[model samples]
Target: MLELRLAQGNLLKKVLEPIKDLVNDANFDCTPTCLSLQGHTPMAFVVLSLRAEGFEHYKCDRNISMGMNLTYMAKMLKCADNDDIITIKADDDESDKVHFVFENPNQSKISDLEMNLMDIDSERLGIPEGEHHATVRMPSAEFSRICKDLSSIGDTVEISVTEEGLKFSTTGEFASANIICKHNTKVEKAEEATIIEMNKAVSLPFALRYMNSFIKATPLSNTVTISLSSEFPLMVQYDIAEMGYIRFYLASKIEEAEYEQ
Candidate 1:
């Protein structure tokens, strides 16, 4: 028997939207301290995983690998009776605890909460495991601005990094954008004493998707940190709230177009 209430329903709604693109009919791991799920986008080219843990008193470590279609769930919640507590129920012989809760003040449709337990042993999501070339901290606001500006120029963004500074630029289409942080920028907090170098760029589309997913969970901030390399995934971190943070790893989208001589 578990009962919990959240003040804001939009938070959960927003969290589920982007994830809905990646979460299919898959099993989710639910433990006493957390409820998490990680699934690959059908063919496993892209993966999405989420964990909501340590919010309240929790017990047990039961793995709830139940296949609940996220699209169905999202639609259900959209029209669910926003009553109050989103209750989750658990049955006997409880290998995993299942409970029910309410949305705002309405009741969620019974048909929308269906789930199935299947064999979910292997994990599909994996992070880059390699030595990074450069690591630096900046403001999330600034980073977000760069992404927005680069996106304005074209569908692709080129990130150039060097020991002196970091450059964000875009071209090739009917638009153009560029931003240079020469060792220090007032809009961002740079640690000049450290080894922060870059001379590379990745696609703005991929970066936008990955970065938006990471920073979407919390309030926008002025400070962010990043770790990057020419051949490794870029690591972006943002302080969402007082003590909460969201980190994202975006794979480098290397361009294959040859420049005309």
Candidate 2:
């Protein structure tokens, strides 16, 4: 048996929205302490890793893998409210369906949902940490808005990070626009403060659509983290309060010609 309940259903909503688009089917690796998912998008350009700790309440017979139909799960989560407590349960050996219960304490309302699970066979990437040319942390809303504004002008957005700050820009056939956010040294909430660490300056270009897709996680966390290096995939991570994190790895579009000054 596997059972978990979250204080807020929206946390699960924000976490699954961006991932469901990447793949129709996936697996949720459930343990006594954590539930995690790892898979690539259909196109295979972007990879995702999602982990949510046992918040509120958790119970598991043992370690097990529960296959998920992400599309069905996404649609089911639409019924959830930010304040509603969400609970999930399933018998690891009995049913092919996972059950959900949503409770709104203030409204004295409750709803139940269920979706049939699938047996998904997929490749999971090994995420190895290494030194990055630049690592920056800032308010997630700022990052989401930057991507939104630039995406209106072009399909691709370039991110340049240095000791000074971070820059976001886009270029079209006749126009180019840029925006920069400098690091903030002081802030009351350590989680919301902007911070930067750089070993060397680094710049890379990525699809604006993908960046925008990642913004959906803004509802899940207050701060966003970005890591970039020439030799590795671009990493964008968001911490979901007590629920762990949602991480994305995207390949940068590289051209030696574009690097020429």
* Number of the top-ranking candidate, with lDDT as the measure: 2
The regions of model 1 sitting more than 4 angstroms off are 1-9, 22-26, 41-53, 59-61, 79-85, 90-100, 103-124, 182-224, 238-247, 255-261
> lDDT tens digits, residues 122-197, model 2?
7556775689899999999888888898888888888998766898889978788999888886877876677888
173 in model 1: Cα distance from truth in Å? Answer: 2.0
Candidate 1: clashing residue pairs, number: 31
Residues 36-74 of candidate 1 have per-residue lDDT tens digits of: 555543222222333344233233445555556678767
lDDT of 1 at 3: 31
Candidate 1 positional error at 77, Å: 3.6
Measured by TM-score, how close is model 2 to the native structure? 0.88
Best by TM-score: 2
Clashing pairs in model 2, backbone N/Cα/C closer than 3 A:
none
